[model samples]
Target: MGLIRKTLGTALAVAAGGAGYLTATTNLTTPLSADDELWSSRSFKRFNRHRNPSIQDVCWKSIPLSDVRPELRENEEALTMEFCRGAWAGYAYAPQRAIMSITNKGPKTENQLFDEQQLASSKYELGTRFSDHFEVVERTRNSVTLRGGGSPLEPGPREVDGLFVISAKLNRQAGTVDVGLKTVFFNSAEPTGKKPAPFFVELLHRYYARAMVDDGARRLTRKTP
Candidate 1:
């Protein structure tokens, strides 16, 4: 009986330790900057009434801007298209659940410009689960602003909208390019009061920030040798 009691106590301690480790690892504790904002449950409640709700957040990444700029200029259309398509598939975020296929509407022009009208009229498929879409509202030499959304095809009113602005600048003194990705999520329903950020939403933001950094780094690396 003494031996059995000791074994059970040991097992319980091990289980508690494992639980603690998992909680620590999954907790959203990423540091924030003056420019960054996280969407908390409270923010959601405040914006619940409007047709579009906004959750503003900012994330930054460093890359070889000099090397990337030339490539972007040379193949802006192709690169932008690839970025948008990959975004729906979860890119580096959720590889196993990435979108299976994507389609670009209208003529294949030298510059692929999908403004608000174009985006509103077109539809995309994400593994038969969701219909994804985006609109390129503005584009320039070093920046692009757009809005994206996804909706389930099944009989439900579930949908999500997002606004994203990506900009790249060369820090000549630092010898690096600073890329900033500002994102705003629109909620369909309003929130009731101030609440902490949802775990899933926080996770999504982190994944997206990391993915953007990775994508920029990959592009710069490819141009190196």
Candidate 2:
């Protein structure tokens, strides 16, 4: 829990329910890059940025945390987000409950900035991210795929709620990241794994999926502020 701090605590603390609808009653300037699926939802204000790599720093508000538990909130509250300076992840558009993301927000450098290793990948946001660098796999409702690098950080089997989760150890070799997900027991035994990404980044993607929608212009605001 070394990464645990106030900001990160708050990010993970915010959970989500079913797909919440944002009203589109009024005409607004939609981003040209807005994806069709995202444009159709109320949760996402913009669609194209949901998966951008250059976007590192982010700030959002009025997120969907209505159904989250106080225990979860408290658990997340203790973490500081400072540790995430390296690489961070977030949702650019309002993705369906089914789709999520993991971003990169590490120190700015040529290799860090230029590497968009995830472009060719599809499905299983977490696995496809860094699978090329570590032993990572994904189990989606449709398929179970593997995307791993030659190097594997062995994590003994661990269960969270009767499901296997990505337990890649962080703080290993510097600049090295590992992450996984609770990929078992979906509609199918096999989930989708595109690749692997940094460990802390996995946290960012998972939590950001349920994080706040930064674009208020997309949401239906009350007459009063």
Candidate 3:
């Protein structure tokens, strides 16, 4: 009986150790702060955005925000043009996987379009057929906020409503920019009263978020000449 108990205890210890390692490596916890501005809006439903029936993924990076801020401020047209001109080629999930197009209904003159007020209302298409629409909702000398959402490229019976906010802060003195990207996906197919998405799906989202942040950081570093 003593030997049997020892064997069982060793097995339990190994299982616990493995579980701890998996948790550490996966980083499955949500990283959002309660004070983020995104949570302040009345339209921003916390339950719909972060809890059951929705999946939120966040990605962040600290790089040379100055390098990217210029393009972001240059105007919606210029930003879209740069993205299409291959500035973001290396950061895409797959080779030539994503494409963007802009529709500037605000102004015809380039100078006027660059004005922050005019740029806020511009619309963009992330894929061939309006996979996402983007707008510059807020901006300042040191920060910019873009809000966007649309259907997923993947087809399924489930209807998806996604809202994303990409907030960037530049610290020129430190030569670093901190970018926080938050995406919340709401699925209509989920039965009423159902729980959040399965663990594996959330895990994949976390990995994808990390990949996006890493890729953006790499691209920014490469452009910091």
TM-score of each: 0.47, 0.19, 0.48
Q: Candidate 2: lDDT of 192?
A: 26
Q: For residues 80-196, what per-residue lDDT tens digits would candidate 3 score against the true structure?
A: 332322212334344223332233222332222222222223332332222233334444343333333432333322344445554445555786665545666665444455534
Better of 1 and 2 by TM-score: 1
Which parts of model 3 are misplaced by more than 4 Å? Answer: 1-31, 42-53, 64-88, 95-159, 188-191
Candidate 1's displacement at residue 173, Å, is 3.6
How does candidate 1 score on lDDT?
Answer: 0.45
Task: Compose the digit string of candidate 1's lDDT tens values, residues 101-187.
Answer: 234332332233233223222222222222234444455555555545442222222245555655555566776665555666665
Question: After superposition, which runs of candidate 1 have C-alpha atoms over 4 Å from their true positions?
Answer: 1-54, 64-131, 151-159, 188-197
lDDT of 2 by residue, 1-225 (tens): 656787677665543222222122111121223343323332122211132221112222221222222222222211111111111222332232113223323332112211222321222333433322222243332222332212123322211101222222222234221221212111111222321234475445434322323222122121211
Rank candidates, TM-score, best first.
Answer: 3, 1, 2
Residue pairs with backbone atoms closer than 3 Å in model 1 (clashes): 42-194, 42-195, 45-191, 45-192, 48-189, 48-190, 89-99
Pick by TM-score: which candidate is best? 3
Task: State in Å the error of residue 22, model 1.
Answer: 19
